[model samples]
Target: MIGEQGDGESVGTSAGNKRCRNKQQAGKDVAVQGTNDSSIVSKCSMASLGYFNDGFLKGFVNKTTRRAPLINRGYYVRAKAVDYSLHCFLQKTASYSQRQILSLGAGFDSLYFRLKASGELENVIVYEVDFPDVVQRKATLIKNKQEFMELIGCMNEIKPAQMDNLYLCGLDYKLLGIDMTEIVDLDNLLMETGLNPACPTLLLSEVVLTYMRDASSSAVIHWAANRFSSAIFVVYEQIRPDDPFGQVMQQHFTHLNSTLHALTQFPGKEAQRKRFLSEGWEECHCIDMNEFYTGFIPEQEKRRIEMLEPFDEYEEWHLKCSHYLILSASKGDLKTCLSFHPPPDFHAIKLDTFDPLWICVSPCEIESENPLLRRFAHCSSLIAPNIVLISGGFGSRAGHHGRLRGATLMTKSGPVWKCSFVGNEGSIHLLTERMFHSMTSFCDSCCVIFGGRTSPLKPVTSVLLLKCEVGDGTISSISLSVKEIECIGTAPSPRWRHTATEVIYKGQRYLFIYGGRSPKEMVLNDWHFLNLEDYSWADIPVIGPTPESRHSHSACSWKGGVLIAGGLGATQIPLASVFHLRPTQSGFFWNRIEVTGSFIPRYSHTAHILDDKLFLLGGVTIYSDSIPEVTLIDLKTGQSLDYHINTNLVKWPVMLHNHSSVLLVKERQVLVVGGGGNCFSFGTHLNHQPVLLQLPEIK
Candidate 1:
């Protein structure tokens, strides 16, 4: 009698625990379903802008929100990649009499309507499976839309009121409410719903599987491999969960309660490929969105998309691409359906030497409040011996964030630095709020500011001449005044992301401006000689072929000439070519230098010429596994060497691109002023403190 009483209590306890677990799982499932809403809205935005031809996506979302250009481009690539995979599978198995497409966790996707409207589903059947609630709602949406109804062509409702979960059934389309993790029941239901075990099938999972528990997701993969005879399984999801951008991406999903389960184990493309191959798949192929866009998409198509909107956030776009990837695993006859094709620049160099040059980096300990230091893409000029002037960028102050309108001067004393804001104490506003502008210091008290933009659409044209005056009252701070200067002759077009170097032509000082993007032009290669003495554009005669047009390139005045380093080219790829505009008696000529070493193609970095060597600091590269390092190129010997940063000495994440760096010649240090980027859907990250990188001597 006591044993029976104990058994009854145990059963009650187990029942209560099961109910609690079910409640938690239900909450997580609801969060996962919410991702579909946001994703479909982004798809609607992309389609509305004519990024892709999908008239049916509009029917899914109630209201379309216009996404930023960066987000639009991101969705564009994703849709294109998924569409390409489906088309490839169709074409590869066209000879077969029947083919099937099973989309796991499909939520409000209009794939069937799109393919049907295009007459591409002649012998193809699409099966969409999702949660019972999501499937029921999708069924209601389809039944209500006349367009979807016509495309689907007389679908039968299977016990709709009773919520049997079969939802909708049509000739070529089937929408079922089935839990994919319950492989046994899911397999039986799919078979009962006319899923052929021997037919050529294509399984599609977009941003699904990752939200499930790790074992559950793995079981789904294994079940798919075992259930199909000739099939191709395509997955689109996130990878690289440890990097700064990847961490932010993971956190974004985690905040939504839709954690990505695959990223921890399969952190990259290769790891993902291996995961499928080990899960009873014949062959697997994987590539990040960067490679897919460059290698698979045509140039004409890319150009057409580029013209859809004004975009300048290339760093965020590339980072987003690198974090997400698509994989295709095939079994039986569809083994060759997905083959990896790397882009031309996807290969990495194998270093022969064991010893690598290392640079120690440490954050600067400022002696005063450093709110002004929280900015990126701002210009920094060493105007005085111990003072550096910083001006113009999108930043935050006193909890208000916007484009900075004032200047800040950093004065170095012994080992500590103090920052004082040079505000608009005068009557009128002197400095215009901008980013990616150039400020060249000609003397201790004076500097000239050139073109930049308030946004990608508004480019600044007026040239500003700034003069700094030191009062006898304080040695730690200086006051600045700005004056607009007009130049005679044909001035360069309004542009930003260009370089203005101080070059001397026949003992006369001139600011040589070269290569920037304008509101009208994507990139400009034309150069102009600005005579500082008369403030006039001087005409120089005779020149070789101009270097490829680029912006975000690094240029430094060297040997009365200007040295141009790596930059993003017209093809949206980073350029590794280095050019020198050697000044001649009559004019300047372009001289391409061949540096002998494995150099990574990069852009958005700062360059400095010191001791006949060019130091390229902190940039973005698509194919690199880690962030770029300090690259030293010998001007005389035509040799290049890379030095890795000792990140152990640093306290914070060092985002080098879009940051300013100053060469401290005497201290043998490089002061990285401000750098970070809008980490693609995560948030904007700005460097909290400036870092000083101690340089080492090159052999």
Candidate 2:
């Protein structure tokens, strides 16, 4: 908790770290409106990306960067998104007179200066307004900063600390128009520069609207719209209300959580731009955070992109952010305004996940990861609830030698790595302990494993199970009680490289297997389920709509039969659609789903069930290696929702893929123990600092 200053008020209190109000503090605390009457803004550099590296979202950002937000995927994505878009926005017009560029709540931004330095705005004059502390901090950064000096120095060209040509007004817009003047005395500054409102382009607002009270934010738009004749406003921000990238920041800073202080109205970006329509700013176009990379970007650029965030939902950081949206508009007719902003310049980098988070590592976190585990070829394994389990053609590490080792067990207290030691140490199965296969959990402490090739050329049809135990302490180790159990049933066919799932029916546990490879054929479409209690595999007659025979599709437990979302083989192209089935109900009812909206068809994406909600995590999109975009589909409601999950988070944050996400001792933290990424919402591109660079970290 932050200690009160002599004035009885907390100093440097940020959105992420505010002292919870108690009787004593609440009675004594007098809310002090910012007294920095000077025209400037104060913004703390809050690290938002690290929040995505939580117990589930790991495997997306590098662990180092997630732990250190100042440098992760969040940082780079923000830099590139803003710089590229801004550059494109500015390079268009030849003149800049009436084109007013006002950045709302501008935080230590350098766009105005960068454009000025390039002489790109010879006819343009920029205006920035913010809190006093923020403006001062930016000034100080420019004066003393090294690597960032050049960037900040660009703004120093017009500074009285309040800005000359670029007037820097420092007043809270949450109150709206009370302290603001119709004119800020910037006429001389503009006269000296010979620029006014009759020219070309105008306006640049980046990641600024989230901090506003809707009315005030709208007022800003209204004010700018009225001030400029033909201005093309550019605004950028993360608009999700419950975004993991912004909400989790409450841990690091008080009052900053979406629940605490974010603007409540005009929530989504589309809604925001539409709000401008009422204010006379016509011809608005917006890009959802995800579309920025998907629709605008080429397939190749998307793969190399990655954003950052914290690792857990309850950890010190867990803010969800989506969209680096750019909105352009004008006061005149729609056609002219639309012509100002070019579409070709608006490319989205599809490879990056919206927010960054590390996979989980705690017991509670792991229990949420996977109740079932699987062992496949090499270290390669598959887990049901594809949302979090990871897969790999990349091979293995340590003793577990393949990719996607679903061989993990999460108890109420911690995660027990059982796949590494099938049957007990003394068991005959442990003698040649098999690795690399398929696995999922059934009942209290049982898991099933299957087919995995030792090498690219080899194939094996073997299934195994390791019993779990309710042990003591965080799951650092587990000693299996079952000795030997390499049980085989009259399974459909001997195959490797397939997906597996477990479901309960008529009070019995059944394992459903789908799509694998055989020595004779490269891919097979066989749906088989093994009864764990009877140790027998049965081919239930599956009826209803079905896709072509295929493998690698994410088969997860839905209503009954596993919901297969994506996979490869048929037509040699990956699948983008999803389907579900019933395991034991007469003929397995297979239902094909409508893969609509922004849902890209491909393989390698993960789908997991949480609170009965199916969340699809990162997977290969289309023909690219870029991770699958994450989405949420409520089984009870059948309503599909889109959310930003670190594409690499397919390993854990909300889910885990091929990797092992083991929950640690803490109920809040989960460890991505090993294997392909499989766990909860924790992991990192490193510490997930917020995209808004200047927001201070919550202490």
Candidate 3:
């Protein structure tokens, strides 16, 4: 498809990048250092990235044979998985008052940085963990490439009701000069980075996961699960079973002597995924990269295509085209899940509503007079009072250190936000996790957590009830209706970073699950019903061409059905379209609907639904940073509205994912909370600031 873009040329091969190969060689100096000690050997075989440098010539051959973007489908797979998983975790933790983030194997990754750039982070702390070499390399690269878009993170301007910073831990996985585990103990790492885990935290791993043994990787996740109030682990790696092109590419790589480190144990990608899930982490959802590219590329979109061309003599080698998919999963309702819906229009502004907002509290101003919003410079999320919600976001400190947190809640006093208050752990009950999916409140007292990141895992096969009792004018921490609910019939896997929406039929809460990762980290399109009263999960087969297994899509309930907005579909690329569904006694009835204008196909955006109306707010746009675009979907008339606002007018428009929110007292606004970006999804790179926004009057 790329070959025919501008010149309409065929997909031709090119000379492999000699620079990369040389760098790969340069990477070898640290390879297998001090091999004399077998204890060091036990420390880590994960050094395959260096080991693959076994034969320089072979590595070169592999490089020359493939193009630049040589279907590194495996990397994409892992990237998607990790991305989706983090998204899910942030979504699930939306209700938490404080949020913390950790990115393992954070090699040259920019998720956290971008969020901070957009001014969306609040009272959050992000700790980026990577090998000393990688950390140093990334630091240097970021500094050298400071002017580039990748380095531009959310400017820590807004101050929330609390104080936090984006923290970085540059440590060597090879501890004691060698402890082989590769992954540093998170607790120690956090301490080293000066971060706290008492709050909710999200963890991420990319191509790094496939490189380690399944057991080793799982150990990291298991440990993470027990660390914070709500923790999420996202992994990225390939999962293609029989990739023909991959074999040819590997053949050439073997010829070049490149470091085939990530490919060391697994013969192929899916094997790595399957193995990982079987090890301990639950398998949630999976997506094929090829399928992702095909659906989104549009047979055009050129420059992106050129990046993939093999540099070394394209004609001589046979190129195998591979696909990539992003799978996500999480430990509890923390993330790796799914949902559906549309945002509510701000036109219905009312008094006494909770309108969520995001901001970064400057460290210098953390102890300001109104710590509730002292340095609170700006915020994101649609400015409205109807159905309210905001997605997770990232922020940076005034000088670059801690991360931000996000939460959501409702009360008679009105919407309120508290960034990272590790001091008070009361923000865990609300979820400020959506920047895209629309939300619906079944009643004035109920706020249902559904379809979002925390994407996929083993579904509890039951509905969780908080039985919210808004006493004393404010909503109190909710207690679970049941200790645990098991499923005997069909159930959705535990998912993070997916969409979940409620279908209010016959005055009963029917939670529908779809488009999330599996325990093994693959995307899925299966729908299961959760009867709130019965407190059980039931497989209800849905009909129609199911949308691709996706995460980060916006879904809302209105008119007598559900509406889906644009979002990432676990494919390497995101999608911009709308889908609607009607729920019946049996299952879901799907129907595809396209809005007039193309909405940004993004993740970590917020959506809310009310009175047959859906509201959409800031999220990732063509520019990695979030854009302030307000959109509305009307289910009653089968139409949608798009509103392009001057974000500059709002001071700072943040994709405040995982931020917190509380309903404005006796108002129509829903207070959104805080969260940071992962793998650089938003504009900023860090999420350690706190601030709030009085969502503008949504018209």
Candidate 4:
């Protein structure tokens, strides 16, 4: 299935080498031909140049004319998509403790150098292969440029004789010259470069296979499939050649006299997926650039880049993007190594459709346990693995008003719940009796609780600290401490129903608090930060458009920012809006997320970050009924899915206000405990005890 130019030629190693050499030589030999290897390489260089121009990449300088804004944005999207795939592979293999990357037909690509500059290559080995002539040119350029050479940690000169194939001993970088169609040479060079087939590997082929014959390219794919025990092979190239836009694209390459040989044979997404599946790959997924740009890229980033230049080529841009596709094929432990599918194992609940078939874990069964008093508006923080410390809420028990206790939700065969009071037997003095406060774990053995109401009309300005020895499968003892943070300037008024999250900045931990109801019944949007080291408070001036003052919202740390969603706004109306507070040099800035998918606005819900997705469970909706819905938001793609729980597991709590959820990372589940209900005002619904909601498999 070779191209028309050499349909009858033998697909042997020598023939493949001849084909590669001829392709390279033709560029210099026939200047009149529009299509040549040098021209193809120039296009790649131009794409990279576009990325640099559009600010998608840095440290790269373009020596040629600037491209159109549309072209630059297109290239930026392409580079970003490929880079994301590369990052995903790296992240997946990180658990295995070893990883390697191999780029086939790599010509003038700067990925390895960029990663090295970012210090991401510390534990990774990178290898690049290209034609001998091309490799020679690149090696010579690197040798002459001190900056390029330094990237590989080279202190000495690179000898001209060793330019064809050599490894940088100190940098884990290997550059080689090999005809990829020649399987024996490819395998030999790979072995010489010290490739470990058992290690998780990422093999990238971007626009490289289109120049090879069908037999040749398929052979390369098959070789990688058979050799690497665990690997992900990614391909980026043009497809869909029959449509008008695709015809123009094909004609453009044809006019250059460089036929897209492999693309002609496999010219669509389905064809590409089938190609990998037939080549012994265990899994394959193919998506066009259009879908990737619209659905996969983060919306905030997309918005930021869209304003970089004036763009009006919408139709052409869509067509052009649709014509290019990214295909990934994986072999061996697809989920553990290189799964391209969205996490398949998710437990969720939606409101509108409460299907009966879905299932939730049974309420934990405990025998002869002194359970904590029925309470709402309490705070819970996981100070240690399998241990949760809950404190201070409105309750009916004699000692429940200002109580502090610890519970161990152990998982050996199944979940086991045990409760024990913390602090010395006679020492039970806390800063104040409070409810609707926030508790965040810090320093491994301690937790900090901030601002809550001691009564409906009074808020406490005190912060409490709880330190305990709960690890090692037993809780030997616990201690209570208090701190009064001092503010040099104006301090935020005491409030309840606020949100507090821990953030790490410049090697120091700080607590950021946002939005709540003041003691005067006034809603507030003020933000403050408490330095953990000094017990000092600082009022942060918020920049950009701020979210409306709200209370009973949920907030969690994500990508160095706090994601706040679903709360009662200033108008006393429940809000579905989501906002992110990002740290800046001047102050904190707010970004209101324009999220897609149907999201129900609710307050007093619990949100947890599991893997890369945000899970929102059980909340009071606008209608004042407990919403039995679970919403999952993918942090990277910003896609949301709402699923309804099968209430038959236990009678669903009528209300979910002031509840707490702790993520069990090892068990892949969340333990949701204690909330109020319409039927049972301020107490726990005994029938709806603590429940374990499963999470997706860890990536």
Candidate 5:
């Protein structure tokens, strides 16, 4: 009798622990469902802006908030990728009398209504599976909309109260509400609901499986492969969890209590493809959205969408695409099925190979009294051997975030750096209240500042000359003066994200401003020469052929002229071509210099020319898993190679885009100051301290 009593108590304790685990899991499931609400709202925003023609997305979203242009472009690509997969599946099995589409974790998606309205569901059936609560809510929303009910041809068929797992039963559509983690019950439920095993099936899991436990998600993949005679599985999820962008993306989901489990194991495209092949699949193909956007989408369609909104967030857009991918796995007769094919002209630089070049990176030691360095899209120039001038960025000011109305001067004393804010109460405000401006120092005490924007629509057009005076090389005795420069001639358009390099023409100094964007124009290709002696637009032109129109490119003075490389081209693609403005007896002529290397194309980087070698630092690229590397190109040999930076010495995520960098020639080090951007929906990330990268000895 005592033994029986002990067994009863042990059973009670086991049941109590099981209930606690179940409750915790239920809460996580709710958080995962919340992601669908936000996703649909973004989709609705894209749809309303004519990115795509989806008439039924409005029924799913309660309030349609217009998202940023970056978010809209993100959703547009996602919708196109999924639609591409679905259309491919249907076209391949068109002769087959029956086919099925099963969307896993499909929460409030208007897939069925959209497909039905398009008359693409002639002999096709779509089955949606999700949590019971989400399915019920979706059903309620659908029933409340008369157009949805009419499209489904079941005005009174979906009885939400009577539904437990099967929320709706129609001639071609089925809505099932159940926990997919219960693999055994889910299989039984699908089989009992008239799912034909012989039919060609396509399973869709859009940012869904990553939310579940790895084992649970794998079981679903395994079950689908075994159950369907011929099938294709399409999955969309995040990758590259170790990079700065990936870290921010993972943290965003973690903060919402919905962690992405698969990223820890399958962190990239190759791992994701192998994941399905290891779990009872014959073949798999994977590509990131970056590849899809450049290779798969039609040019006309791309051009149409690119002009739908004013966009200057190319860094965020490309980074967002690189972090996510679409993968398709197949089994049985559908082993040849693929979502899309890579373009014949597509070629990616092999970034995983070892490069011989390396550099050491460390954070700069700044005094505690220095102003906060949390800013991006700012300008930094080497005003003196020990003084760095930083001005104009979108960052924190007076504990609030906006365009900075002040400039900071960083002076080096011994090995420590000290910074003080320049006055903002007077003429300095004109030079400090702008972002994406260009600053070129003409001498040790003077620099020319021109062309920036307070906002996308408010660009600063007036030119300003800043002069610095240093006394006894002390921080307390340094003073600065700013004056407006009135140039006589036709000036260039008001622009930002341009480069101003000092080039010598006939032993006369000139500030050559080239390639920027304006609020009215997305990209500008024209160039102008500001004669530094007279401060007027010089009209000495003998150009053979100009480079492509671009912005956010890197330029530096080389061989008495300007050498420009790597910028976002007119098509919004990063350019890999390099051009040198060779000074001639007649005037200046553009010369194309062919660079030989497996160089990944990038933009928004800083460049410097030293001893016949051009060093390009820290840019945004969509083709590689690594952060921006210092690309070294030999000007004489036309050879280039990427040098990796040892980021272990830095204490924070080294996001290099939209930042400024200055090369200390005497120290043989580059100071990377103030970088980072609004990382999609994750949040704004600004590097709080300046990082210094020591250059290695080059031959």
Candidate 6:
């Protein structure tokens, strides 16, 4: 019933077009006899059935009316597109003091009444034209319903209404009857009803043109184009008439004796655009329903409506949506009136919808005196609340090999980066040149640096302590001190690429070291701890199923334990598994975490705990060269989601692995320091500078 069209004044038909015209006319006659109204009027009722089913219209229409779910979705999409276009037209022309809306072949369309009730009809004139019979029935319905009359401010008012020819007029509203094929009479009626040519106008035609002969439809379009100085014409109709789905759709209307004459001529968006352009319109835009759903519809509202029905016909739905389209043509100042971006008031029309959560990262300005030298495998730790200490790593810089520097995080200076201290100017320096090391903040003033490799075959077990103080709005001074720890038991062997985390146990501070490659290049899964109170080392026995020996892994303190994720496993392949370690009275217990989502196996990445969630940033993966991905893992549920940084606004780092990341908790940003460049081969060396990545608020 919804897809059916009504019969219009007969035109000279060629032998080739006789079958279609006769079938359509016969279907209209059958529909009128069956329902006591024109097929087009019943089609409007079918649309109302869909609106009520999809929750777009509630209590405004009869509750007993019902339609199929697919039909409802189709009608809902039509309603949304029409409403959005009207609002966009109005907003674009808000500066114009006078505006008008003309609805061609409008039959039982509650748009005027709805807009009037919503107070959107203020200072605007609306006109609807249809056949004499259709207009008389609609006028009678409006006259009998006080609720409908009240919308146009005609309630309880004595007014002369002609039922034979069907002419009604109210404040800012008019309904008239005219045969669309007769352009002379249509033009005369519009002129008699005080149509103004200078006013901005919006013309709407939904599934109306296809019912008329080609010449008649073209004549109507030309008349409107010549009448309005500034105007936009919006039309929604079927497309792809020859395709499988479209063929079925044509058959449905044909069986109902409704002809789609215009569809055969303008069967697609390109043809529709061409129609407007040839008709003297300045500009035209045409998009199919699939594009409208994906690109124009608000994603938040799309998700909400998707949940309203049980839909499993995805392939069919896509095919069906692709067969329908909305076309707009504009002249004069109306070109800027149509914006796909949702306006601020768009949410007011959507019920039971929520805004989608979006995460984005943009670049921040850096104000350092000297650019950071290119490097990789470097380690960094927060020495103070707003100060970070960066130490030795592989680089192209000519130096004694070992280097230490301090980066002062700027607060009120507006996203600026500054180097506070470097080289011998700092109180302390590394004992030797090293890379692939670990640094962990011990307290508010001290940080501990652990094992690393001075060269491929050379690994050191030395532990250094850094004492720093914030002064003059910078890390003005740093004192490097060596810790002479007394060993009560066997200590861990010399290893590189290990993880060291500072944790609290029984109201006392301790440092935990786990899994890395030993000096022999063998991966080790041993565990050890150092008591900060006495600086004593002790071997900690591990229980339960032990994690695979790994190197270049990442770990962080969580809930008085340690959470380790991703590293080079057996055969030097990146691992995707996650493991948690909990302190036990006997030793430490290990548990493998079950995670869900498309987890990327990576190594040389960095991880930080924020708001009880583990955030994994920038790493080299097996599948990709260097990943600029930000992955959030829920510590409690093990649920994970991945988000990529918006590289359009900020230049992406050449490489993410072997980098240092420190979270600025107050600012909710991560400062990523030097790492590798594009090429992964050691023969081709390229190092990147530092970048500040802004994180969206989680809530």
Q: For this target, which candidate reaches the highest TM-score against the unseen true structure?
A: 5
User: Which candidate order results from sorting by lDDT in descending order?
Assistant: 5, 1, 6, 4, 2, 3
Query: Which lDDT values do the candidates have, in the order given?
Result: 0.84, 0.44, 0.41, 0.65, 0.86, 0.66
Question: What TM-score quantifies how close candidate 6 is to the native fold?
Answer: 0.46
**TM-score of every candidate relative to the true structure:** 0.93, 0.48, 0.40, 0.46, 0.94, 0.46
Give the alpha carbon lDDT tens digit for every residue of 181-276 in model 6. Answer: 778877877776767888999999987877766778888888888888899999887777753345556766665556677888888777878987
Clashes of each: 0, 200, 267, 8, 0, 3
Which has the higher TM-score value, candidate number 1 or candidate number 2? 1
lDDT of 3 by residue, 14-91 (tens): 335444444554454244221112211211121122211112112111122321222233233233434445555556
> What TM value does model 1 have?
0.93
On the 0 to 100 scale, the lDDT of residue 4 in model 5 is 27
Model 2, 1-699: lDDT tens per residue? 346443234666663444354443332211111212111111111123322112211211123222233224334444454555555545555443334455554554555544545556544445555544445545454445453344233332333332332332221011011112223443333333334555554566665544443544566678667766666776666454333333333222233222222334555555766777787786777655334433454554533332222211111111222323556666642225433232453332343346542222222223232322332122322222211222222223343423332233332322322222232244433323333346576665555656655443455555566555544523444444333344555656766557778766666777877886665665688777788787777656778876667665566676655777766644434566677786555657777666444454545444555556555654433222233445556666566544443323233223223333321122322233232321112222121100000111111
Instruction: Give the alpha carbon lDDT tens digit for every residue of 557-663 in model 1.
Output: 98888999999888888889999998898888889988888777888999998888889998887776555677889989989888878777665667788889888
Task: Using TM-score as the measure, name the better of candidate 3 and candidate 5.
Answer: 5
What's the lDDT for residue 317 in model 4? 53
Task: Tell me how candidate 6 scores on lDDT.
Answer: 0.66
What's the CA RMSD for each of the models?
4.4, 14.4, 24.9, 24.5, 4.0, 24.6
Preferred candidate (lDDT higher): 3 or 5: 5
Candidate 4, residues 142-210, lDDT tens digits: the string is 666666778778533443343346533334778787667678877877786677899888999887788
Residue-level lDDT of model 5, residues 564-616, one tens digit each, is 99999887888888999989998999999889876778899988877788888
lDDT of 5: 0.86
